[model samples]
Target chain A: MKHQRKPCSLEHARFLRARKKNLAIVWALRIGLLVLLLGIWELVTAVGWSDPFLTSSPSRIAKTIAGLYSDGSLFYHIGVTLAETLIGFAIAVAAGCLIALALWWSETLRKVLEPYIVVLNALPKIALGPLIIIWFGTGSKAIVFMTVLVGIIVAILHMLNAFIATDKNKILLLRSMGASKLQILLKLVIPSSLASFISMLKIAVGMAWIGSIMGEYIVSRAGLGYLIVYGGQVFKLDLVMSATCILCVLAAGMYFLVVLLEKVLVKNPDS
Target chain B: MKKEMLRFSSVTYIYHTVRGETEATRGLSFTVEEGEFVAVIGPSGCGKSTLLSLAAGLLKPSEGEVTRSGSCGYMLQRDELFPWRTIEKNLYLPLEVSKQNSPELRRRAKDLAVKYGLGEFLQSYPPQLSGGMRQRAALIRTLATDPDLLLLDEPFSALDYQTRLNVTADVAEIIRSEGKTALLITHDISEAISLADRVLVLSGRPARVSYTHELDFGDLKNPLKRRESAGFSGWFEILWKELNQ
Candidate 1:
């Protein structure tokens, strides 16, 4: 009788066990780096190596967060800032998609508007903050307008390139199948540009936050940006640091939301 | 005996560039019979794609008439399935474009997907599919509109050698089973011999038909099986010599 070979289940199990160990090691290394940085910052402040008042340690920022939470000011300011960022982002997306569609539809209009778009995109959006406040009177309207101004141009540029770069052969294929021009745009062009559009939306999320913050910095009654400016005026470094941290968390949350939407819509996790 | 589905009479195409006009196809005349599979083979840059383009009404002939009886579905070399759309949505693209998006048609498209092996992957995006599956999905998308004539422009040239053979067999069976007329433009001699009922070989640029051969491989249906037939090598050798000449 000839000897038979087995399936080598032990080797397979060993590979799996090693993979788990490697993943755990990577996670531990990441957590260790974060802890070490926090520990060093705390140690430096406690030992009088750096002034906690000026550079506000992580513990001071954490205490400030708790204090603000107890007083309910943190939630209120966060709500206001979030509203501004979201409204601005929504307007930018709508306007940007529309402008991109218009440019994709007509070469003549694209040619006519190309120079103006380039010039406006090159201009510093921050410089327009004062003019926007003057025009919209330092209210939520000014913040929203500034956000749209900052985010829409970049979104339009990205989406337009996506739309224009759509597969020409595919377009011709659709056209030969008796598809109308509007149908091509809705079916082929829109579907093809969706991934790029999602990426642009994620980018616009950050720009929207930045725009909203700049607006709040110039003129706002209540917001995280206003809190930062107010804290700086009163020489409260902890408050300023806490407000910055909150902004970071909020922006990250929004960005992750867009990424999740992309995952659901595009259905390709790798992309 | 079949009725003529497409007639290309003295069709001439010229590539008008900044340099000047260079003829791509000169006075090419051919007629595709109804329910026939005709493969156009030629050397590289010999206007095979131009022929399909003219047939599909994508490119207007500079001289003479290129007329077809009914609607045309053109498939490119690469499977251009939209990465964002599900396989099911991609299949419904033609119907959606034609404003034929009835619930019944949508269900039929789904049924077709299921009838094909893609039922399990209907909700999957293009990137999730293997190259062969994507091509099948693309073929389904092309066939969704129920076009009278299908123009395949080197639709399998992108696949690897092994995958190409399997895909060619699958596609040939699918097209034959659907009872649709097809015009395949390819440079692969074996591919042309295996899938087509008739093959027309073209010469270099300003392309014209050099020879037309009627392929008969007895009862061999699958392309790979057909390749093992006695007549397969003979046809391939003839085509290879003609292509080189």
Candidate 2:
């Protein structure tokens, strides 16, 4: 039987209007809350309720950003940090996929290397900072290496779980049709694990940021991390706060990019 | 020669795990002749699924020989339609995996989708379709490989009781129309009676063939029509007794 939906156009329009109104309120509240917090901070500092030196005022941060913008160093720092993060995130995803595939392809190799991977994952990656600097030298290479080091393990773990957890029934279905190992992997294993791959990318993006920042804390000539370190050392509280705020915006931007990519790549039911 | 499509000569299957071995089926012997529709009914957890696994050559018989002619297609209980793929793409999977995804074959698969009442849902993913539609897509997927023998393992169990009846009838009609030999494993005695040209009642695990019934309701092809036949309840009653015993 053909489905017959009641065409209550008036009710439908009213429902849509209510939904839109509620959504607009939610967004308005979100922005309003942020503005209120910033306004309070500015008020407190301007009215001498708190020491501006200890707690940097929003106006001071804005003035510091304006200063950096005129100096041409702001874009340079943002560029360096973004490039490092993107490169590190890319390398880690590619290498981690290859490693996960290797582990999946050979049970013996997986068994032999599984323990070492676990140990590496458990060990604090920041401890390896000094050694990484020495091996790659005190440059962007060291920071990139650190970023990759932080991100690759989690990527491998997420993907390996997904690969191993491929539906055994689907594999059997393929095998019954005379499909070979490569056929099954290409047709079933990888395609079915796309969600896991995207999840790993999301997680690894955060790791990449942490690694780059941590590396700069150890040693760096330029980048957002360096700006923060330099600002801290010079007792420029406004610069420190400004750099941190920029980092937050950039990280959130990259995360949204990944979310957009998920929209494009994953055919998720809800998405 | 009746052109044997599949023959299981005293097959025995033993499951090995960390907790040791469990014999799922033992001395299980049967033959599916060409163009036959056979249903196997047994107690729950009676290694009915194991029988299909062995027929599909996914499991080795520990003690007996299994000879199957041509390719085998397996239809699962949950439909196992890839959630990411559209109905058309889902049907194309077997062909793609088999490396026979020619334009001609793709067209044929699309045609099958249209013919099977999935025409409107060609671009819709499995999740968008109802449970019964998903199962139909899965059956079409299995049939895409043009397998000589189809092994159906409780393919209708996941549906609601009402949908189950309709889908069982639909699927049985499709299999018959395709002229492929089918070995269906179901616990539903009425389902077995309605769909099968022959019914094999199985013993409890280490399951073996307990008894066999040859059914003849001349021109009683459709599952609903077969169920409505005067002889249908007679077969259900006999199989029920055999299964209980």
Candidate 3:
């Protein structure tokens, strides 16, 4: 048995080596593509093939970011946006889960409110921008509300579907064991929907960022969105580009954070 | 003189949908006595599941009386083990839900797993185990809370033929050794004849007990042994004819 197992282990090792090599090649290609794109953009602007003033190159964006760093405003703008996004995301997930539970608890309530939820999810959220500013008066409060608004509806829908789609047999088993409704919810429904919850978080991260940026675009004194608006108005395209780059990095970082959370919480990949 | 564990007397169940109300079972009457392994066989889509649900007390009868003496454990067609939980944790689920959580019950549940050849895979999740092992885990889970009656709804139908035979033997051994009353609903004639002390056959839709038979195997409790017995084919033929008619 030991002699037979040796060849099988050797085959498994070879398979693992091939997989690692393939992953390395994919990563190298991804990085190479990004570098090539940036290099070409720089070359085009420097050779005067494209106007640098209109479309800021990588170097100009970097220089603008460096200047923002020296003035200590880069971190400030990032912090404001990040705070709004995190708080809004946390609130949206918590409140959405609670509301979904409430809906699951009472079928009558869900029936009455489901149509309105569908309508709200359908109606473009940006259409409420002007009213939002009037109500909250152009502050961080308004931005946070916007972020929550964008994310909460999707969260509710995703979680509610997951809760309802729980296996009927498992519920029947629980009922046979004399489990109450609350017991069923706690022991079965909530735990079973965890995969959906993680997926919802992944989606809500993107929505949260969009909401904060959209809110900032409508009204903000300091944020990446504000920087872009101010730079565009004053014709400083490099500052706008720099702010956009920072937003991309921030969004990616937030998305990875959620991915990390999914890894920690969801032990069963099949589930 | 045997104690009645479950009694369903002229039980009727109606399911209401947007289209209309459909009667799943009508005037279904049966009684399972203590330490009896009774198998109820029916045609496919003959409200077998509705019968199990009614026995488990998950659905109340629309017309007749349904009485269960004590708490019952239900095992479904699919193993229905929570994929997210390890086999051990899945076994503890019933105990947790029924508020029977204690060291003694947990230990007994673990002992059952070890006794049933699942000791090595107790820490493994449902997906990691084979189909037969998962079903065994599911049975152990059902027995965890020590319910008085076991309501089995075609628990072996999901398995392939080979695994189904082995699992049938294992389940019969466990239920018999544990001395629990079990009411298993299945469409498999051989399974009904092999594992059950008494067999009840149901008619097509709007199910009712059309026939009942007490096997003369006397002390023959092992499922595989019963299958190899001379009387097994005769019993199977009778049941098949009854079901077809």
Give Cα-based local distance difference scores for all models.
Answer: 0.89, 0.90, 0.91
lDDT of 2 at B119: 96
Q: Which 10 residues in a row give candidate 2 chain B its minimum summed lDDT?
A: B80-89
Best by DockQ: 3
List A-chain TM-scores for all predictions: 0.92, 0.94, 0.95
Q: Is model 1 an incorrect, acceptable, medium or high docking prediction?
A: medium
Can you write out model 2's per-residue Cα lDDT over B98-140, one digit (the tens) per residue?
7899998888888877898999998888888899998999999
Model 1 Cα shift for residue A180 (angstroms): 1.8
Better of 2 and 3 by DockQ: 3
- i-RMS for every candidate (Å) is 1.8, 1.5, 1.6
Question: What is the lDDT, from 0 to 100, of the residue B191 in candidate 3?
Answer: 90
Tens digits of per-residue lDDT for model 1 on A32-139? Answer: 999999899999999999999998999999999999999998899999999999999999999999999999999999999999999999999888776887799978
| Clash count list over all predictions | 0, 0, 0
What is the Cα-based lDDT of residue B230 in candidate 3? 94
Model 1: number of clashes?
0
Q: Kindly provide the TM-score of model 1 when superposed on the true structure, using C-alpha atoms.
A: 0.86
- Per-residue lDDT of candidate 3, residues B129-148 (tens digit): 88999999999999998889
Determine which window of 10 residues in candidate 1 chain B has minimal summed lDDT.
B217-226
Off by over 4 Å in 2: A1-8, A268-271
